[model samples]
Target chain A: MTQSVAMTINGRRREDHVEPRLLLVHYLREVAGLTGTHIACDTSQCGACTVLIDGEAVKSCSVFTVQANGRQVTTIEGLAEDGVLHPVQQAFWNEHGLQCGFCTPGFIMAAAYLLKQNPSPTDEEIERGLEGNLCRCTGYENIRKAVRSASQAMNGTAAEPSAQLVGSAAAPVED
Target chain B: MITAPFEYARPGSVDETQSLLNKYGSDAKVIAGGQSLIPLMRLRLSQPTALIDIQGIPGLNEVRRDNGSVEIGALVRHVDIQRNAMLRESLPILVEMSNDVGDNQVRNLGTIGGVIAHGDAAGDYNAAALMLDAEIITNKRRHQARDFYRDIFTTALEHDEVVTAVRFPVSTGRFAYTKFRRRLYDWAIAGVAVQETGSSWRVGYVNLATTPRRGSAVEAALAGGASAADAAAQSGSDIDPTSDVRATAEYKRHLTQVLTVRTLQKATMAA
Candidate 1:
C-alpha cells in the first residue's frame, strides 16, 4: 500500500506517495534523488547509509520512509552552504581521509554529527563515536585524523591545510 | 532491497496497539524503533502481514523509578537509557551495556523492549537484563527474567501480548559487562556480565548458547565463598554453546572463564 508522507529534506519541504515497505535509504536515493547516501550492506552493520535526522545521525537503511514523516533530514549534499564545504567535508579532503572514497560521505556525515555533540572528542571518543562506520580502504588512521582535524577546523583554529602539510603545493611552478 | 508488502498502523495508545494486535493476531508485528525488526523484515526472516508501529504510543517511552525498581518503558530508546541519570545511578550495568550495543546510530534508534523481545542470544541487553534480574512487563502479564527466554529468537510473549516496560531492581552493588566481538558493534562471540549484590555475586553469559543464561554454577560457587578464579572455572558448566563462524564451543567456553574472571575483578574494583 502507498501512503502520502511529508518531510523536510535538505532544507526543502517534500511530500510524496511512498510504499509502506520503502526504506528511507531508497526514498532518499531514488525518490528524492539524493544519491550521496549509499547502501554498503543489506544488514545494519555497515554505516554507509548514515544521515542526519533532527540534527542526530542515524542509519537511513534501518528506517522506513513512512516513519520519517514531518521529520527533518540532512543528507551529505546538504552539508555545504553557499558553495563552501562544511568543516568536516573540508577536513576529510585535506587530511587525505579517503583512498577509495566509497565510505567518505558516510564518515563525514557521522563525524559532522559527532562533532556537533562533542566538539573536542578524545581519540577514544572519536573511536567510539565512529564505531558504527567501517572503512576497508584507509584502515581508519586517516579517517581518525580527519575527524580530529575537522574538530579543530570547526573550532576556527585555522591549522595548516592538509595539502600543504603533505608537501603537495597547489600552485604551478614558474619555469 | 524491498520488504514484503504489509499493512501499517501507527497506534497512538497502548490500548489501540493491543487491539490491533488482537485484530491481526499472529499476522501482526509490533515495531517500536524498527532497529531490529526492520532488518529482519527486509531479509524476509520475518514476514508479518501488518506492522503495528508503537513509536507514538503514549506512556511507553518513559524511564522512571517505581517501587524501588527502575521501570524502563519498552519504547525507551537505547540513547535515552544511556543518558538517563536514574538508570545510570541505579543500574549502571544497563548503561554500560547500552553503550556497547551496535553503535551510536543503532542506540539512537533501537528500543530496549525491541531488543529484549527479539530474544537474540547474542544481544547485549539480554545478558544485562538477565544479570540484573529484570522483570519483563507486558500488557497481559509480567515475566521474570529467568523465565523470559524460550530459545533463540523466541520469548515468553503471547501472541497478542505487548511488552510495555522492563523493571530492574536498583542496585547499590557493583556490576560490569565484557563482550568479545570481532569488530565494534558486532554481536559478541562470547560475553559475560558479573554483578555483586551485597556479598553475593551473579554471572550471566551471552553468545554462549541459544539463549542468554546465567552461570549458575559460578554464582553458586561464588556464593559458597569460592575465589574468583575457582568460580570462573565453572562458567561453562551450565551451557552447551555451539561452534559457529565466530568461535568454537570450546573457545567460547574458554572465553566464558576469561571474561568471567575479568568481569568479576572489574565488579569487585567498582565495589
Candidate 2:
C-alpha cells in the first residue's frame, strides 16, 4: 500500500503518496524532480545519494521516503540561495573538485553539512568527514583541497580560483 | 531496487509500538532510522510483512545519566551518541566505537539499538556494548550486554520484544578499540575492544566468530598476571573465525592478536 508522506524540501512543503518501500533518493529524484541528488551506487557503499535531513547528512538510499515524513530535507539543489552558489559549491568550482561531475553534488552537500558543523576542520577532519564519498576519477587531492577551500571560504578567506581553473583545464587538455 | 510490499504503522508512543509488535509478532519489524534494515529490505534478505516505524515515538531518543549509569534510548542515533557530552565523558569507548560505525551519513541514519539488535558480527556497536558491560533493556525482558548477543543476526530479543533503552554503568577506567578494515566504511575483518578496570582488563573480539565474544583466554592470561603482549597472543585461542572475502581465518587470527595487543597497550597507557 502507498502511504502519504509530507516533508519540507528546500523551504517548500511537499506531499506525495509513496510506496512504503520507496527509497528517499527515488522520492527526491522522481517525485520532487530534484535530480541534483544523484544515485551513483545502489548500495549504501556510495555516498552519491547524500542529503541533509534535519540539518544532518544522511544516505538517502538507506532511508525510506515514509520514514522522512515531517522532516526537513535539503538536497544539493537547495544548497544555494538567492541566485548565489553556496560556499561549498563555489569552493568545488574554485578548487576543481569535480572530474566527470557525477559525484560533485553529493560531495558538495556532504561538505556543506560538514562545514556548517565544523567551520574550521583540520585536514584529518576533512578526510574523516569525506570518507564516505568515493570519486573514481579525481584521485581525491582536489576534493580534499576543495573541502579545505570551502572551509576557508565559509570562514571569509576565499582561495585563489584561477590556480585551480588552470589545473582543471590543463588536465582535460592533457587527456 | 523495490522493497517487498509491507504494511506501515507510525506509532506515537512506546506502549503503542509494543502493542503493534504484539499484534504482528515476527511478521513485523521495528524500524528506527532504517540504516541497516532498509538496505536489507532492498536486497530482499528481510521481507517482513509490516514495519512499525518507532521514530515518531517520544522519549525514546534521549541519552541521559541516571543514578550511576548512562541510559541511552533505543532510538538514539549514532551521531547523537558520538556528540553527546555525557556519553563522551562517561563512556568514550562508545563514542569512539560510534565514530567507526559506517561514515557520517550512515552514523547519522543508524541508531545504536538498531545496530545492536541487528546483531551483525562485524557491527561496531556489539563490541562496544560488550566491552562496556551495558544492559539491553527491552519491553519484554532486560538482558546484560554480554547476554544480549546470541549469534550472528540473532539476539536475546523475543519475536514480539523491542529494545527500549540501554544502560551503561559509569566507570573511571580506560578503554580502547582497534579494528582492521580494508576501507573507511567497510566492516572490520577482525577487531578488539579492551577495557581496563581497577586491576583487571576485559577483552572483547569482533568478526572473529559468528558472534561478538569475549577473549576469554586472553582475559584469563591477563588475570593470571601474564604480560599484556603474552595475554593478547591468546586472543583467538578460544574462538573460531571464518574466512570471508575480507580476509582468511589465519589472517583474521593474526589481526585479532595484533589488534588485541595494541588495544590492551593503549588502554593500559590511558589508565
> What is the C-alpha local distance difference test score of candidate 1?
0.86
The reply for model 1, stretches above 4 Å from the true place, is A160-175
lDDT agreement of model 2 with the native:
0.84
Pairs of residues clashing in candidate 2: none
Task: Report how closely model 1 matches the true complex, as a DockQ value.
Answer: 0.72
> What's the i-RMS for candidate 2 in angstroms?
0.9
In terms of lDDT, which candidate is strongest? 1
Residue A50 lDDT in candidate 2: 94
Prediction-by-prediction clash tally? 0, 0
What are the Cα lDDT values of the candidates? Answer: 0.86, 0.84
Candidate 1 lDDT tens digits, B86-122: 8888888889888888888998889999988899888
Q: In model 2, how large is the Cα lDDT of residue B201? A: 79
Please list, in the order the candidates appear, how each scores on TM-score for chain B only.
Answer: 0.97, 0.96
Best-performing candidate as measured by DockQ: 2
